[model samples]
Target chain A: MSTTRLARTGGPRPAAAAGRGRSLWRTVRASGWSYAYLAPFVVLTAAFVVYPIFASLGYTFYDWDGIGEPSDFVGLANFKQVATDGYFWRALGNSALYTLVLVPVQLVLALVLALVLNNPRLRGSTFYRALYFLPAITSIAIVGIVLKLMLANFGDAVSKPFLKLGLTDEPLQFLGSPHLSMWTVIAIGIWNTLGYNMIYFLAGLQTIPKDQYEAAQIDGAGRFAQFVHVTIPGLRNVGLVIVFLAIVGSLQVFDLVMVLTGGGPFYSSDVITTYIYREAFGQVGTGVAVEPHIGLASAASFLFGLLLLVVTSGQMLAIRRLRARKEGK
Target chain B: MTELKGARARRGLTHLVLLAIGFAYVYPFLWAVGSSLKTKIDFLDGGLGLLPSRPVWENYAQAWREASFGTYFVNTLVISVTTVAFTLLFTAMAGYALARHTFPGKKIILGVILATYLLPHGYTIVPIYDLINSLGLLNTLTSVILAQVGGGLVFGTFMFMAYFSTLPRELEEAARVDGAGFNTLFFRVMLPVSKPMMATLGLFTFISSWNNFFLPLVFTLGRPELRTVGVGLYAFTNQTTTDWTLLCAGAVISLAPIVVVFVVAQRYIVEAIAGAVKA
Candidate 1:
């Protein structure tokens, strides 16, 4: 079967090379066009994407203000500072909180919406899907800005009706109060990206064959039982991927927080990205002026990246183990 | 008859629920556009009402002039277009090569690409900033465009590679039978045939570059005149004092182009995203 597959694919096979050197040279010559084609991408990625990662690692060791060369070589001090800093911890905790709240809530909401819109019998499913997804395509920064303005201007507008209905006597400060800011940001974050997850869930729903539902019905399964037995199990793989993507995306929340509150009423909504941005480029939109600390920011960034790596790999391993145990059963 | 009526009622409820949620989802944008056209006093007093007593068309013009949005709009266009063009060309060539040819170091390249993709680089801007500074391209549109293009190439290349791999081998053979050389075949046949993929990638790139705030903000820190609409709007809020109508107008202006793009290409964009997640 493998040989037939290879034959069908039809690629140039080595003609029993007498020596490795000659075949290597022949292969290189044959791939000239490939090298030519790959040159630009290789050059650009190496320069911009890959090199910056290593360069930032190097920057983490020094106390640089992003002005001149790194004459002040403070070894591990930046990392130590990042490790011990209160604001860094706050930012890290905020990011974790954001992800912890966002992923499950957003995923559940998305799945429910997907199920609703996935019904072929439902009229105007396409229109509903598009309507839900419209915000996902718009810039998050714009969304944050518009929401900030609306909340500021329309705070009374929203509160008046609620107050009259006796929902609450007091108006809410969405971005002002320290207690409310992070939750408010989380709510907006969910709204902003919910559509992407909804679309993913919709696609996953399509992949689960209709025959499974029919089979469940034949077994006297109710709607809820069929969902539990067929839908959940069928969506397991795609569900894992969606969860991973959502968590990763949430952990890097910068634009919205930066624009909305600038991580403030006093570091309440500061996620790791906003923390890094503030350190690297001082605090913008705030009246206070602070110096840019590139080294500390780099350290903070690398630390967060390391944490993400561990979390993601652990998730992957858990997934593998679960899959293996199921197969074993 | 009663059972059928019950089913009909259930469907109506579903639509009702969906319509309500959908309205809430889209209400903020609708409010922004409405507020943009409202007089300042009306905006303040209208509270939840979407219509203005009289439309304030001057708000958009004032936003365009006062915020320097015209310049920022032009800069954003140039940067997004250049970045998308370069990204498409470079990624297509590399993707086609990777898909079609067997070469030494291919595994290494693929491995590096995968590793980079997995590792989050949200904070790598520090070094990238330093690198661009050293190149004497700091505060220039070129810096922003280059960074955007470079950062996107990995994902674009990966996408194009998958797309190219799915194309039938018979097409390449046919081109070769017609005495087409590598360059001729790719430029004339392969690239043209790949228009749909290009559109998908191009639309994605355009939306991202158009909406991007951080890179443009950081790169153009020294030159406020060089800000994109996103950065410019942010600055407008900071510089001006509670010009709520103008700010709303500015936000709407910045958002209009991208919304139009999304509306026009909604089908392709949705499919592309869905396809990407599944893949």
Candidate 2:
């Protein structure tokens, strides 16, 4: 609807409306009003959004701490350093691992939950849905911090329960151990985000015609077969939305890590954003201290941004191609 | 008859699994709320327990007073309210204009807006931080509000455009025939008709700005007084790592408003989130 309106409004001027000179003046006057209406959006986007993107790119080329103007023009040095930086690569790899694991797991969990809750005969679905989604609305920083406290050394709440259940003899350093920290972060991530995805899938599922299932049932399809044929196909668009968002969101994971581990256990849990933050803002007490490298941070962010764009676009294209092929078949 | 019995069995099992998962999902917040009411020693003892032995309500007061959560709450309110207000105003204006009229460079502007939606703020945050510093707005609520509103505008505009496009053109045409100007047409005609969409976007923006951590953490790094609840809780826990009772209390305090708002406006929230998939 909006695009059609946009096209209608933006279409070529009617040929017989007026003389050329007067029509040009009318067009100019109309544009003036439109620009007047859009001035705040334009100015704010230019100042805040557009400027920052180009500025960050420009900052990547020069050696300047975040405080001052760039005096030393070190061409590609920041890029070169980032190229060889193990921590930067590690951060990217960790983010990749997170996106890889979290997206599909979150989607499956969300789909299952959505399907279960979508049943018309289910009792207390509203309460259960609200309960499950409570964490989705809370501050992630607070959740991460509270979770860390709950899961603290052996006598802590989470650890005590695990020990009592005979899951382990000692406290599991979920956020403390390097190996477990990232996965713990991923788990908390999935837990917090699962409901949001569930909502998406539920919305998608609600749009499917109920008679499709009725048709399948009449054709002797079992529940599982109906789910596979009717429900999964119905959810494709919603699944794509979740996948795209999950990829973008996972790449930008910072708040949880900042509060939970601060990329601790020797930078083992660092995502690109945390790594960039420490590089730009300087983290202390984390055992991986480097002088605040604003230039390199900017470079790393820019490079990562490019990589994310490429990955996202590539995935979108792949989805498109697959859909096209499916339609063709 | 056996098939009917099997269906009943399946339904019972489904409820069992749902209830169990719901408990696991909600236990953390419940634990935090329960722990917040405990003294330090009691907290450690009953940390995982749903009920506190002695509910020390004063823990809330302690967190409120000592942690300066009052200031953080005010700061967050100021930031979220201002950000949401500006986001609604600017995006609505932009959306109405883009929807109702065409101008030179409209395509370019729309393309840029769409691109901004895809571009994560994390990548450009360094320069944004620098930009705020250069403007002398660092460590101020204004800086965070400005950035939040700015970051929120594109999506808000997108939402507004989608809604405004669907609105009947006859209303605007009638207003124009009555000799109403652009301001009257928009402020009087369009704004009144667009309340539902506005509410959805306003809640969306408010919740996000309220929960925003990373930007405020950057902007208010030096000024603790300017910290929002998210950043304040972060700073609080960092300083008082051993005070689980107080920290948990602070967490509950910060989470309380959100929970209440969420419960009250869950329909709107769910609708907005679900609608986001379409956008």
TM for every model, in the order presented, reads 0.95, 0.94
Per-residue lDDT of model 1, residues B102-122, tens digit only:
776788999998988767664
- Number of the top candidate by DockQ? 2
Model 2 stretches with alpha carbons more than 4 Å out: A1-10, A14-26, A153-169, A284-290, A326-329, B1-6, B119-122
Which stretches in model 1 have alpha-carbon errors above 4 Å? A1-23, A161-169, A322-329
lDDT of 1 by residue, A1-329 (tens): 22222334546556666876787676677677888999999998998899987888999999988889988999999999998999999999999999999999999999999999999999999899999998888988887898888887677775677789997769878899899899999999999999999999998989999999999999999999999999999888788888888988999888899888999988999999989998988987667888989999999989887878877887688779878988999
lDDT of 2 by residue, A1-329 (tens): 23234446666655675586676566656567678889999888888888887888888888987656888899999999999999999998999998899999998898888988999999888888888888888888888888887777323556767889998888778988897899999999999888888888888999899999999999999989998999988877777777888888888888888898898778889999899989998884344456888899999988988887886777678778878988899
Clashes of each: 0, 0
lDDT of each: 0.88, 0.84
**Candidate 2 RMSD to the correct structure:** 3.0
